[model samples]
Target: MNKNWSAFNIVSVVFGFTFLYLPIVLLIVYSFNASKLVTVWGGFSTHWYSEMLSNQGLMDAAWVTARVGLLSATVATVLGTLAALTLVRHTRFRGRTLFTGMVYAPLVMPEVITGLSLLLLFVSIGFERGFWTVSLAHITFSMCFVAVVVQSRLVSYDMSLEEAAQDLGCTPFEAFYKITLPVILPAVIAGWMLAFTLSLDDLVIASFTSGPGATTLPMKIFSQVRLGVTPEINAVCTVLIGFVATGVIIASLINKRRMVNNARTDADI
Candidate 1:
């Protein structure tokens, strides 16, 4: 019975992974297809990739998306780190629970609601919808993710390190820069990557907030997707999947290297 259960568990795991990844795998495969219709497979060709490069409008949207991701991720990371520090390091504050709820509220809120609220806010303030507005909206939601990631890391971190740094006569800011920042740096980077990925993948929020001249890649893809699935969309999907996969692989490698280094240090000790 135990052996049968174990086999079932293995099958379940495999099915789950296949279910999650099969669509992405198929999309990447279709990107190289010679057929214009994304559903039908033709002999492999690099035509879509070449077309992706030459399509000026798509290229421009991609560039805009990249810029938005970078800017929003950076801003979100900074703000989130500060918020995390405030939540974790500070002992007491009025409405702390309220603050925490607000910080994480975005993660739970429906995307349509968030987008609508932001749209209303922008319109009420007479802020023109454009790249900057989109960036601002991205930052609002992305920062919540960063705060959660950093907060989790900070919970496991040794506060004694910062105390020791203070004992060595470092100012609070200096101690944080020298001791706390280095320790939490990996989590910060992971948070930034998360924010970047979220910004890049955003469609609903970007759609509601973006202006005519500042359409993001996802927004552009979504608009086109309504028409019909095409090889061009598949090509874009393939590129995005490549980026996500690359980031995951690199993060895994870094973590593995860190574990090995820690094990070696333990052996030496």
Candidate 2:
């Protein structure tokens, strides 16, 4: 904690960040390489980025990934929040333990098993695998993570505020919408972001669930990597990483602003 501990603090911070970001930095840098080979960088160029954008297959996959991530994350956040509310509100309901277990079981389950189980269920029901199936699979697993994030906040939430609003003749939905939602918006946003990132980065589950015309970005890059990692791949990855980083920064800023506003309102009250 001491600023006087300069050497130890400097070493720790430098090492920690270097360990985490060096590979990413290298990857980003190489994405601009003029050479075709990923490792042998000739000089800086934007050709790879141009090529990556021009590739129809890659662009289509990116579009599918974006749509799947958006749809699944939104739905997962809604369902997960509802599940968390059930756990937090109906604390004494019958079969609550079983329900809780079912809701959260995916968090600890192996991706392979989850994917396979979903595959089997789909097959049994005669459902076709495609963009919809991939999206469904992502939603299935991502909701559990959202529930975990939301439940943590809900557990510490002040329910009296909602009850007070209801006592003032506000309907349950109105009370929740006007009072509870603003307070928990940050957690919901965080959960949505987590679900989006998970769906975006998922390879294993997507592999099992995806069918023709449903190839995700990760799957595309992975399948191509078997041939070789090219500068184009690096460019695509850099773009994906940039997109996620931007989203996280924007969400964090919004969450902080909301928290500050809530604090000011609370102080006035």
Among the numbered candidates, top TM-score falls to 2
What are the runs in model 1 whose C-alpha is more than 4 Å off? Answer: 1-5
True-vs-predicted CA distance for residue 105, candidate 1, Å: 0.8
Tens-digit lDDT track of model 2 for 1-269:
78698997899999999999999999999999999988997998999999998999999999999999999999999999998899889989889999999997898899999989999988899999999999999998999888889889989989999999999999999999999988788899899999999999999999998889999999999999999989999999999989999998998898789879989999999
lDDT of 1 by residue, 33-121 (tens): 99888888889999999998898889999999999999999999999999999889885899889988999899999999999999999
Q: How many residue pairs clash in each candidate?
A: 0, 0
TM-score of each candidate structure, all chains considered together: 0.94, 0.95
For candidate 2, the per-residue lDDT at 147 reads: 87
Off by over 4 Å in 2: 1-6, 267-269
Could you list the CA RMSD of all candidates, in the order they appear? 1.8, 1.6
TM-score of 2: 0.95
